[model samples]
Target: MKIFENCHLFHYPFEKVSAAHWQKYPNEYATHVVAVDTLDRKVLPDSQTLYTERLITCRQGVPRWILKLVDGAQECYIREVSYMDLKSRTLTLLSSNMTFCDRLRVHETVTYSPHHELNATVFRQEARIEALACMKRLANIVEQWSVDRISQKASIGKLGFENVLKQINLSVFHQLPVPSPDANS
Candidate 1:
């Protein structure tokens, strides 16, 4: 088993950051994420929290040797669940791989909360890799590689969220406007 963790500050308030997260993916920084499908989404009975489930398909960027081990398929599916609390200004996400479960399992959890001091939003991510290989050595290698890959993905996701935030006017989220491609132009 291997573990990965990351924490970062987004220069936006919790509401803006949470909205950007919901609108994340299908953006410029997420080329690796090929497709996203919503399985379920609904506002909780209390009307303050939203629960969502989505399946995202991404292109795997592993070594050639690893690809060989994965039947040479370049894509994988991940199941994600998210809870967004409007009153508390918090968002929690949990995700795990749907494919390659027997040989490798990657589970990730993320939280977004307000940063009082910075007046921004703090993002925290943690991931664990379980590689059930016959040989201990191979399992260790795969686990390490999975951690490295997840770390890289987290960085990309941050950039993607930042880009999305830049495109929108943070004051309003209900409109769900698309960021202008020519904002700088």
Candidate 2:
């Protein structure tokens, strides 16, 4: 088993970052992310939190050596669940691999919140990788490879999200004018 953790600061407000996260897919930098399907979404009874569950399909090619072990599968499926709390200005995401259950598994947690002493948002990510005991000789190699791949993806993913934030005017989320009740009359 191997653990990887990283933290970064986005020079944007928490609200902006949180809103952009939903629209991050289809960005050029994250082309590996092929599809995103929302399985479920709901606002909690508290009225301050929104919960979402999604399945993400990623088109990734692994090393040839690893391919032989997993029967040449090139697509990865991930199950992601997220919680966004409006009152706390925080967004938390939990994601895990759904493919190759017998060979390996990667579970990740990511959070976005306001910085303590700055006007920016803080992004933190942690991934736990486990190579199943079945691959006694290749376990170490698999774990290390997963860590490296995840690190690279993290950088690209951040860049993609930054682009998303730039293209969308986040303030518009709150600034949209409400139509008059009698406008249709």
> Pick by TM-score: which candidate is best?
2
Q: For candidate 2, lDDT tens digit of each residue in 1-185? A: 99999999999889888988998899999888899999999999957999999999998878899888888998989999999989888999999999886899999999999998998999999999999989978899999999999999888888888879877765566688889999989
Model 1 alpha-carbon drift over 4 Å, by segment: 170-185
Tens-digit per-residue lDDT, 1-185, candidate 1: 88999999998888888888867878987898898999999999967999999999999677998887788888999999999988888899999999887778889999999997887999999998998865366898888888887788788878888889887754456577787999869
How big is the positional error of residue 183 in model 2, measured in Å on the Cα after superposition? 25
Computed on alpha carbons, the lDDT of every model, listed in order, comes to 0.87, 0.91
lDDT of 2: 0.91
lDDT of 2 at 161: 85
Residue-pair clashes, model 2: 0
TM-score of 1: 0.86
Write down the TM-score for model 2: 0.89
